[model samples]
Target: LNIAALLHDVGKIGVYDSSLRKTTRLSNEEILQLKEHPTIGAGIIKRIDFFHDIAPIVRSHHERFDGHGYPDGLANDAIPIESRIICVADAYDAITSKRTYNKPLSPLKAVEEIERNSGTQFDPEVVSALRNALEPNDLPTVQLNEDDFEEFEIPNECDPDYL
Candidate 1:
């Protein structure tokens, strides 16, 4: 379980876009590309010595509790418990993390969103776990003041590339 979850997003390294990687809404092509991350992650784990049992779990973490998820839609008990655990953890992390697309949600808001999506995009059990796991540190703490971006105007003679 640990091994699989740890490597779950490894495939993302190949086609990752730092600018939009954690956005709430992505273009269709970006969504398609993002879906491949799980497969790529599974493949990386499958080649390991003791990870044979973890491959399927890694591959199916993206699946939803209602069988509407990608790759394989093995719902409820059909999905491994370890995978389910990882699912909740992954969701919590994503919800609480700051991204280019959307600011990180407060713990209360994140829980509400997770609970709202229970049984559709996520497992009810996973939702329960998330409700229990939220902590003060789960929220992002980066403070960006307008002064942080303050800079002198560039000279017209300055080369943009060099600047």
Candidate 2:
């Protein structure tokens, strides 16, 4: 699950930097291109033996509980449990993090947004777990610096050049 969470957006490496870094609203073509990330990421993961099992979960992370999401239209149990968990976590992070397109939202506001989408954009069971988890102390916000990461080369199998 953790591996799936970390690599779920790995396909974005293949996306155009302009589309990802643009501050304005994405054009329809850019939106379509952005939606291809999951499929691209899954393809990359599937090439590596150790991560083969997670490729499906990675591909399905964008799937919605109501079967309206992209890449695949899987709904409910049709989607992997790990993918469903990642979907909720991914949405929460996107809502709370500052991006080129939007300002960061407060954790409370983020939770509210997720709650509003329960059973549609997110799984209700996962939503319930999130609510329960947040009922305790507030989660500490961590600010990540680019310097914190050590440079690493892409593995041969996962490298875009090889793919």
Candidate 3:
């Protein structure tokens, strides 16, 4: 599960830098390309035999509980627990992190957004886990003014020395 979570966005490496760094809404074509990251990420993981078990989790993490997600429209319990958990975690981070396009939301506001989307964009069970996890401080809390984008890279077969 940790492996899947860490590498879930590895496919974003294939995306154009301009696209990833864009400060505005994406165009239709750009959105389609961006949505392919999960599939690309899963494929990359599958090539490593040891990571085979995590491939599906990475692939399905974007699936919505309402069966309206991309790549596969899996609904409710059809999605794996690992994927569902990752989805909630990913959503929380995305909501609370400052990105090129938007300011970060307050933690409280982000939680409300998650609550509002329960059973539609996220699994309720997973959201519950998030709420519980937050209450116990399982997740790290950073000062609002802190810069969170520390640079890091995953070395792959073609770039073993990159990192």
Candidate that would win on lDDT: 2
Q: Which stretches of candidate 2 lie over 4 Å from their true place?
A: 136-163
Model 2 agreement with the true structure over 65-111: per-residue lDDT tens digits: 99999798999999999999999999999988878888777677788
Estimate candidate 2's alpha-carbon lDDT, on a 0 to 1 scale: 0.91
What's the TM-score of every candidate structure? Answer: 0.73, 0.83, 0.83
lDDT of 1 by residue, 58-125 (tens): 88888888888877868888988777778877886787666576666766677778888888877787
Which residue pairs clash in candidate 1?
Answer: none
TM-score of 2: 0.83
Model 1, residue 80: distance off in Å is 1.4
List the global CA lDDT of all models.
0.76, 0.91, 0.86
lDDT of 3 by residue, 1-163 (tens): 8888899899887788889999888999999999998899989999999998898898899999999997899999989899999898898899898788878787767877898999999999889878876773444444466554476765686775764
